[model samples]
Target chain A: MKLLQQTILEKGTVLPNGVLKVNTFLNHQIDTGLMIEIGKEFAERFTDSNINKVITIESSGIAPSFFAAHTLDVPLIFARKKKSLTLKDNVYTSQVFSFTKQETSEITVAKEFLAENDRVLIIDDFLANGQAAQGLIDVVKQAGASVAGIGIVIEKTFQPGRQILEDKGYRVESLARVQSLQDGQITFLQEQISVTN
Target chain B: MKLLQQTILEKGTVLPNGVLKVNTFLNHQIDTGLMIEIGKEFAERFTDSNINKVITIESSGIAPSFFAAHTLDVPLIFARKKKSLTLKDNVYTSQVFSFTKQETSEITVAKEFLAENDRVLIIDDFLANGQAAQGLIDVVKQAGASVAGIGIVIEKTFQPGRQILEDKGYRVESLARVQSLQDGQITFLQEQISVTN
Candidate 1:
């Protein structure tokens, strides 16, 4: 978590409309070594949970999800933004509004991939408005899968995303929570939770 | 490579139009252990090349790219599918036509991540028409980076992807090249080159 926080401080950029650009290392381009460390951190945090699979959305969430899945020795499933021709007709889907893209898109996962017996963990790069995470949770519910927990790389704690998930009674863990990014200066929440009870 | 070929034969479903869906292990739902093996294989394949960075597109390519980067001890740079508010104005962009989606979209990489001095290896999930690889190659070229090679997990040799890259004089090494996928039977090319070589 410290490595991720340090990377964000060293490389993340702040833009207008509460957008944090981590393209240099987090999302667009990735530091694989650091990613493995981050994934190990998530696995350590959520090791006690009953997470059988790691779920994420397309584009940004793949790397961390891979790392976490590898660490936990579980399968990684991602909901695709654009449902390709290869997808089956029987799918659990939810429409999500992207504040960044300003467009509504459907995210889907095959019904066969998720089942009532499965425990799922949602993972993502950024947690801003929580719309994307909500969509993934909705898909899991549709498949009758249990929501074990949610893992995020960088979270805008100032936003309502944390509160929304907490309101739903889902345990959320983020590596680096940004307290404020006012005046182009980034701030972090220094509270660290011990993985063990 | 045997493991990958076996996965394709077992989980991969053949669609109507030469499309083989291996989302269960390769793309949508990933098998982490297999991916790690794939990463190790890629590392061994490109060990002799002076690859400074591993470049790929977002979403599907991120998992293998991360593993490959980790194994090879290089930075992984992925091209984002869209322009976000946080990305800088300076970018290397290219258009890729998705055969599965039947549409063309632009993929962009931040200019700073790639440089003239970098030697890149482009990695991807599938190489059908080679549009996605071409897009990534274009971005690398825009950055004046030398492309050491192109690595594909599964290449449909029946398609034009291999020919196109070969025409470009790019060293392409596909772990599993499908010679045919007729009547739900998957066939692999001669293992002499990839296996014995």
Candidate 2:
């Protein structure tokens, strides 16, 4: 978690959209060593959860979740945001609204892939408002599966996502929690912000 | 590679669109163990290429390439198919025509990720017509990075993808090369086909 925090401090940039961009090493262009360590952290945090599978949304979450799943020795399933031509099977779909895009899109997982008996751990790049995680939860519910916990690499705690998931009784663990990214300076939840008296 | 071939034999299905579907383990719902093995296999196969980074296109390519990058101890960069609101910098863009969409889409990678001194290994979920790989190659070219080789989990060799890439002087390696998927039976290149006999 400290390493992730340091990586954020070094490589992350605060965008005008009130978001933290970790494009340099988190998602777009990945730091493999950091990801592997992140995976180990996730596994350690959720070791008692009896997680049978890891689930995530496509594009950004795949890489990190893949490593986590590998470390846990479980399968990983990513919900597809857009259905492609080759994906013609019956799928469990849920609508997820993107605050960034300002539109809702249907996210899906093949109905047959997720079994009812499996316990899943949901992993993602960042948990902001938790819409994406909620969408994945909806899909898992449709398949009669149980979500053991939620593992996030970064959590924007200023948003209501963690509270929302916690209210629903899902065990949530995030390696790095951003308290604020205001005025081009990033702040984490557990770290003290310098207050000039 | 043998495990990949076995996975295809046991779980892969041939869709009516003449595509071999490995949605059960390869793409949609990933078998994390299989993927890790696939990663090691790719690393073993391309060990001598001196690949400093693994490059891929977003969505499906993320999982496999992530493992391969981890195994190779290199960074992984995935070219985003469309630019997002957060992506507002100088990027290396390439237009790729999608046969499914019947239109061209722009694929981009941030300029800073791919460096001129790097030797990249391009990894993809499937290689059918090489449009995706070509788009990535174009981005690497923009960065002045040299492509060591292209690694594919599966290749529909009947398509022009491998031919197109090979003609461009890129060494391509596929774990499972699908020769044909006629009559709902997936066939690989090594197995003697009755038609050829």
Candidate 3:
């Protein structure tokens, strides 16, 4: 988490409308070494949980989710945004609104892939408004699987993303949690976890 | 390669319209172990090449690319289909037509990611019409980088994908080349070097 926070401070760019671009490393042009580290961090955080599968959305989240899934030695199931012609008719779909794209799209997963006994750990690159995470949760519910936890690379904690998931009784752990971006500087919650909190 | 071939024979579903769906283990729901095998095979195939990076497009190609890139200990750079607001204005863009989706989509990579001296190996899930592969090649060309080789998981040799690349003098290698899918049976060109010849 400290390394990720440092990487964000060094490489992440602050865009207008509260958008932080880590495309140079995290999302677009990935550093496999850093990706492996991030995956290891996720594994460490969720080591206590029983995770059978790692679920994520298309595009950006796939890379980190892949490393996490590989590190955890679990299967990764990504929900495709665009409906492929070859997709089977029977699929569990959930409508998701992207605050970044400002469009509503449906994310789908094949029903046969997720079983009732599977415990899924959801991973994503960024969590702002938590729409994407919510959509993934919907797909997991439709499959009748258990939601083990949510692993996020970066979280905009000032927003309602984390609160909503926590309200639903989900364990949401982010590598870098941004408290705010006031005065053109990024703030992170780097406090060590207490022995009993 | 044998493991991959066996996987295809077992899990791959040939759709009515010639679209082979291997989502169970390849794309949608990924098997990390098999993908690691695939990565090992790709590394073995291109062991002699000077591949500094493994380049691929997003969504489907990320998993295999990750495995292959990690095996080779090289960085992986993927072209994003949609330009996020966080993306810079400077990029190498190319239009790719998807036969299955029946639409044309543009893929772009940040200009800073690739350099003239970089030797890139292109990787993708399927090589059907090869538009996606060509589009990736175009990006590499735009960056003034040398393409080391093109690696594909499955190649539909009957389609015009391989011929176009071969005609362009590109070294294209597919793990599983389908000579013909006749009577619901797949014929592989394991002993043959060039499917076109």
Candidate 4:
């Protein structure tokens, strides 16, 4: 987490409307070395949870989740945002609102991929309002699976993303937490363990 | 490649309207072990090309591409389909038509991440009409980057995707080539190498 915090300070850019762009490393243009480290961190943190699968939304979250899934030696399922031709008709779907994109879309996972006995660890690149993670958790709920926890690369603590999931009694962990983004300067907050609390 | 062929034959579903679903292990629900192998294969195939970066589109391509990037010890960049707030304004953009979704959208990669001197290897989940890969190649060209080759997990040989790229003099490689998918049966064609030739 210290290395991630340092990387955010070095490469991250703060945009207007409380948007922090780590596209240079985390989301868009990824550093595979850093990605592996992030994945190892998540795997090390959640190794004791008996996670059978790592669930994430499409686009940004797939990379880190893939690394974590690789480390955990489990399957990683990315909920598709678009209703593609290849996606099956029998899917568990949940509507998600993206505060960044300012549009609501449905995220879906095939019912057969997620089973009732599976313990899923949700992963994402950023958690602002927590709508995306909530949608993934909803899909897991529909499949009757257990929510092991949530792993986030970056979290905007100024928003209520982490609080929303914690209120639901879900274990949420983020590598980088931005307490505030003001005047092109970013502030960091110490990570807290919600599961033990 | 044999393992991939066997996976498609066993787990893939032939959807209505020529849609072959391999999401059980390839895209939606990803098998991390198989993904690592796919990445290793791509790395081995493109090792002599001097690829500095691996380029892909969002959602599906990021996972395999990430592993490929890791294996190659280079960076991986995924083009964004939608313009988001966090993405920089300065980007190399191209339009891509999705036959599965029946729509066209613009894809963009940050200009700083892709350089004119960089040799890129394009990676994608499917090579169906090759429109997505073409769009990526266009973005790379816009940045003045050289494309070493294209790596695809599943290519529909019956479709015009691979031919379009091959006719354009691009080295395109696919792990599993489906000759036909009809009546709930899938026929696979052996992979052909264009890099050596």
Alpha-carbon interface RMSD for all candidates, in angstroms: 1.3, 1.5, 1.3, 1.2
C-alpha lDDT (0 to 100) for residue A131 of candidate 2: 95
| Candidate 1 residue A86 C-alpha distance from true site, Å | 0.9
On a 0 to 100 scale, what is the lDDT of residue B42 in model 3? 86
| Candidate with maximal TM-score | 1
Docking model 3 quality class:
medium
For candidate 2, lDDT tens digit of each residue in A1-197? Answer: 89999999999998887878899897789887898898889988888889998999988888777768888888888888887676766888999998977889899888887899989999998898999999999988889999999999999989999999999999899999999999989999976669999
Docking class of 2: medium
- Considering only chain B, report the TM-score of each candidate against the true chain B: 0.95, 0.92, 0.94, 0.94
Query: Which regions in candidate 4 have their CA more than 4 angstroms from the true location?
Result: A191-197, B190-197
lDDT of each prediction vs. the true structure?
Answer: 0.87, 0.87, 0.87, 0.89
Candidate 4 lDDT over B1-197, as tens digits, reads 88888888888888777788778888888988888899999999999999999999997888778779988999999999987776657888999998888999999888999898999999999998999999999999999999999999998898999989999999988888888887878988755567864
Q: What is the TM-score of chain B in candidate 3?
A: 0.94
Ranking by TM-score: 1, 3, 4, 2
Q: Which stretches of candidate 3 lie over 4 Å from their true place?
A: A195-197, B193-197
Taking the tens digit of each residue's C-alpha lDDT, what string does model 1 give over B1-197?
89999888889888877688888887789898888888889989999998989998878888777778888888898888887666658988899999888888889888989999999999998998999999999999999889999999999888999899999999998889999989877898876655565
Put down candidate 1 lDDT per residue, A68-182, tens digits, no spaces.
8888888999899877788868888899998887899999898889999889989998888899999999999998889999999989898899899999999999989999999
Q: List A-chain TM-scores for all predictions.
A: 0.95, 0.94, 0.95, 0.95
Give the range of the ten consecutive residues with the poorest summed lDDT in model 2 chain A.
A81-90
lDDT at A63, model 2: 73
Clash list (residue pairs), candidate 3: none
